[model samples]
Target: MSDDNKHDRDTPTWERETLQKLVLATVREQRASRRWGIFFRLLTLMMVFLVVWAYFDFDFPSLAEEKIGPHTALIEIDGEIDVEGTGAADNVIPSLNKAFSDEGAAAIVLRINSPGGSPVQAGIIVDEIKRLRAEYPEKPLYVVVDEICASGGYYIAAAADRIYVNKASIVGSVGVLMDGFGFTGLMNKLGVERRLLTAGEHKGFMDPFSPQSESQKQYAQQMLNEIHQQFIAVVREGRGARLKETPDMFSGLFWTGARAVKMGLADGFGTVDTVARDVVKAEDVVDYTQQEGLPERVLKRFGAAVGEGAVKAMTHAPIPSVR
Candidate 1:
């Protein structure tokens, strides 16, 4: 063979191998790019989903409607008034602040339906309402009792300028109560020992495992008396001379709406609509309650159920009854 033909044969083989290698390298590079693209797409989708969820959770629309004229804000106080529960001061105070601060809001109506819980929490709310009323003298605050408003619930209602209750509504439990079950007897029966340690003598004064001492009982009673006095002061200040300081008024006794009005514990027997229309001069009442969205409500319900089930399983006891 001639030198040119030999060169051509070698060059063709080399070029064929180079082309094959180039094709393989391109395929590998395409696969790597495709994998990265897929990963980024998935990450972007996840980020979008999270953003949407957060937006819905935190950006819930206001329950109240915007009105041009003087608006009546309906601030609902439902459930137990504890520090951690749905009727917590932390939850209700913000809504109350918003209602009072709204320039369009002519008056605030506290629509209460609670059996009451923490005295401190109720006091905090009552003080805020008083302060807000003093600051915004133009706007009046009213309480519309629904179903029941007793104990700490009445404490909050008494802070309002006036109170309205339904005819059969239960009202006026103006006393403080601290309740805890003593497990000493039960433990004795079960032969379970309670080992409690504290640095201070009075640290465990209210311990359920130990029998209440005379000194401890006296101290607790004094504290309760002080709290009761404070509650009476709030009622007197809020209701002014209108409140009849009868023995029955602060005797931890509840009364029906008719009797409550007679006793001066309530101003009148009426519903929210009646109060809003007649008292506030606005027929339309706007509710500014902070309600959770559907998804959040579902999640909270599911989580609470799971937690309650787990607790029941661990303790082998029924869930504690609501106060």
Candidate 2:
């Protein structure tokens, strides 16, 4: 009786252990399969994201070609007008050349919407406009101010035979300004030392971290005065006998479209369409602004999207404006 009972008990215990092992192995296999499925899904999503980005970043030219039309060249002057930034000379000058050269173009219109930038850049554009106008005397170049046209912007506008502005347009600043921040006090407070070197005595005259010397200030004032004189000369030349030369005209102050017209800062208050129709007697005006081709736009969009996505993923705060 004891031998039979012992054999039966051993058989049941062995069977139970084998069944338990099989169940455990099945659960482990299911978990592994689920993990691999999740990994594949994530990988597919990433690939799709990459493909979309490439599509936008690389196909701008094709899109532009499709959108371009005859009898109209759209020269866009949007955003800040700086040499290295939006209103770079390289970017706008070439387009201007193209606009002037287009034989089919009836009239070239400068659609300006800027708050002004570097004087050098503005001067270059103004000279080019004058030269081009002289070269093609029959073309009838015109400037149409959109939102704001101040300082360097007005300087550029004065080149045109006629300037058009919206009723509420901020038309003129008629001034020059060179801005910088002095950090000498801040550096001294923080016990930070400046190690700037220069060969000439006045090479670092405008260095923001150092105290400004009286001689340096005087020299800077002289330079600014010279620039102001140059500006006055250009304005007088462009305005001709039309400028009234009042006390406040060139005092670094601005005027609205209505006031500007009364002060002879602008020709008349009108819109692009009005000038094109009434003054030029041409119903169709061409835009000579060069635009980024489809491929460039796509690339830019993709890059921006990727950058924005990365910023979001990392939860970084947006950078503050420098201006």
TM-scores of the candidates are 0.73, 0.66
Residue pairs that clash (backbone atoms under 3 angstroms), model 2: 56-298, 57-298, 57-299, 60-294, 60-295, 61-294, 61-295, 73-287, 75-289
lDDT tens digits by residue: candidate 2, 74-119: 3566766654433656667887788777766557777788887767
Q: After superposition, how far is residue 35 of candidate 2 from its true place, in Å?
A: 35
lDDT of 1 at 6: 87
Q: CA shift at 47, candidate 1, in angstroms?
A: 7.4
Candidate 2 structure, TM-score to reference? 0.66
Candidate 1 segments whose C-alpha is farther than 4 A from its true place: 1-68, 186-193, 292-323
lDDT of 2: 0.71
Give the candidate number with the greatest lDDT: 1
